[model samples]
Target: MRLSAKRHFGIALVVAGALMCLAGAALYVMPGPGFPVLALGLAAVVIGLLLLAALRRE
Candidate 1:
């Protein structure tokens, strides 16, 4: 199963991505479930959304 969400290039998403990345990485150091990798992946997706939204801006 997959979930789809509308892309929105807002600052909030960017912040969330950064937070996720940092936290995930930290967790990874403490013997976690690929949290850093997951964070990076999520950040990448958020970045994509940011780009899409930015382009939409007139």
Candidate 2:
């Protein structure tokens, strides 16, 4: 079956969030990449949340 946009978006959000959590833990060892990873993950989560909200109304 084909995946809906919401599903894909949600998946991305969760994956990104997971990555962010992981990166946060890694910050103690590597601050350079972890900070950027966290930012990207947060952005993904925000975008996904917006997409999910939009989907709900449609």
Candidate 3:
């Protein structure tokens, strides 16, 4: 079945969040700040919730 634009966007956000988390995890073995990337991924998830709410209002 086909998904709506909002649904697709939400899925994309989820994928992005996952990728961010993976990158952050990888960073732990590297040299940068892993915690901040992990926090940003969590923030992206929060933004996804907001996006859903806004979509509902439309």
Model 2 misplaced stretches (Cα beyond 4 Å): 1-3, 28-32
Error of 1 at 49 (Å): 6.2
Provide the clashing-pair count of each candidate structure. 0, 0, 0
Q: Any idea what lDDT model 1 has? A: 0.63
Best by lDDT: 3
User: Residue by residue across 1-58, what tens digits does model 2's lDDT show?
Assistant: 2348667867788777777867765883675556767666677777777777766686
Show pairs that collide, candidate 1: none
Q: Can you write out model 1's per-residue Cα lDDT over 1-58, one digit (the tens) per residue? A: 1122333434456666766777777778788776656667586757867665655673
How many collisions between residues are there in candidate 3? Answer: 0
How would you encode candidate 3's per-residue C-alpha lDDT over 1-58 as one tens digit per residue?
Answer: 2337876787678778878888988896799899889878877777777776777776
Q: How accurate is candidate 2 locally (lDDT)?
A: 0.71
Q: How close is candidate 1 to the true structure, as a TM-score?
A: 0.51
* C-alpha root-mean-square deviation, each candidate: 6.3, 3.2, 3.9
TM-scores of the models, in the order given: 0.51, 0.61, 0.64
